[model samples]
Target: MLFSFSLPFFLSLFSAAQQGPAAAPARVQPSAKIEWRPDRPLTWEDFRSRPATDQLAALTSSSIDAKVGCVDYVFSAQVRAVFVPTESWVRDPKRATPQLLRHEQVHFDLTEVHARLLRQKLSLVKLDCEKLQPAFNNITKMAFLTWQREEARYDQETNHGLNLPRQQAWEQQTQQRLQQLEAFALK
Candidate 1:
């Protein structure tokens, strides 16, 4: 069970953040950010309030805490999705149902989708110590922009999960997208 940082209610622009700045720009321990798993869909119980974000509904961001490194000309890095229970509260516990959960999940799903794309792109990249950070930053920047754009499109197309038909459509679209990027899912 986990609450998340993906907010459709508010549209914030994320660049190579990118990683979220809503929370303080503290250094995140790799262990702190949970990696998104194909088997897991967020549940309401996961939305605990202790580490709350400033009253937002959902937030989806990635921590490529892994800096690009090359040993013997081989490049490697670690990238994962980190879900923090910020900006989550059941408006009506009774009404805070799967319908809404699905919407929130989409927010995180969108983030994971970008993460996959990042992984795919990063996999092919060759790194040299001198050029590593800039190249990595470029990948991060592109992924982050795509993430923000997709978030907006999701909210507009689905009406923040208010329109069931549109919501369903988004679900199908995202699921298909996930399938297309399955090869890049983190191990």
Candidate 2:
């Protein structure tokens, strides 16, 4: 299973002040989600959650949400890359540097690249309802595994944004990948 950052219970309480008692009891308040965009980059202010550990400078909670549907035997899927601010946090805001923020942003960007890849793969799937769910599951599982591996490799190579040269190289490569997958970007 993917490492998810969603915390609906705490989020509901955190947002209780903003939402009155009239809020639906059965429905969990959705946490803050920011869709990946070329123009919008992450910042220290975007890290809203309290730090959970001193071991890491920062944590970026990003994932790709994929949905599939079938109508009249035609199957389709929609994929979105999202960053959850409520679940992302920094060990020390004052200590958080621009380089660190850029690194976190790259993580989100990588999620987008993976989302695009999932979308591209889903687009090519044959319209067979009998096999659609299994196909979707297999494709998404592979993508998620690949995404996690890439993330680990990036963090290791850049040393969590401490290595400026490696960080820059990753940033450049990520940008190129985003451009290459521009055709599959969320509309």
Candidate 3:
């Protein structure tokens, strides 16, 4: 008998200024989704959502999407890092300085970092079909938790881009890690 199964796991990381929540913004149709590309950096135009009436400077909605499958005895997975511009917002164009945008870019890059990390961990999977589901769940769940912590740590350390030195340090660190994991990155 031949057996095969595939499942997808999605983990989203919301990066925003630390502040109390306000009234929800209106919903609008997303124009086009942006996937992570080293050559392509984000711009103010990429933030399409209506800014909330709060102290938030911006919000970035990024996620890791993974699909793992087992066919017969072989296992495979596909992973991607994605950015939703329509869901991301900036409070004001005048305040959308280059530094702030760089901080937000790091948020997206961090999502890609975790995606690569998950891909790296998943690459080590070697199990029978019966063990695939449970193992995959455990790995992905742990990765998601770790990702959350990293995001929080980043915001805390950089103070939402207010700390220029820390933010620059994080930018360099993030770039280094991304390059280190380039082997696991999606083509």
Q: Give candidate 3's error at residue 145 in angstroms.
A: 0.8
The better-scoring model by TM-score among 1 and 3 is 3
Query: Would you list the rank order by TM-score, best first?
Result: 2, 3, 1
**Candidate with maximal TM-score:** 2
Worst 10 residues of 3 by lDDT: 4-13
Write the residue-wise lDDT of candidate 3 on 26-63 in tens digits: 34346776778897787767778876546577777777
Candidate rank order under lDDT: 3, 2, 1
* Best lDDT among the predictions, by candidate number: 3
64: Cα error in model 3, Å: 0.3
Model 2 poorest ten-residue lDDT run? 8-17
TM-scores for every candidate against the unseen true structure: 0.72, 0.82, 0.81
RMSD of 2: 9.7
Model 1 whole-model lDDT (C-alpha atoms):
0.58
Provide the lDDT at 141 for model 1.
71
What local distance difference test score does each model get? Answer: 0.58, 0.70, 0.73
Query: For candidate 2, lDDT tens digit of each residue in 1-187?
Result: 1112221111110101111122111221247687788877777667778877656667788878777877777676778888788888766665455666677888888888888998888787674776666666777788888888888888878877767799899999999999999999877
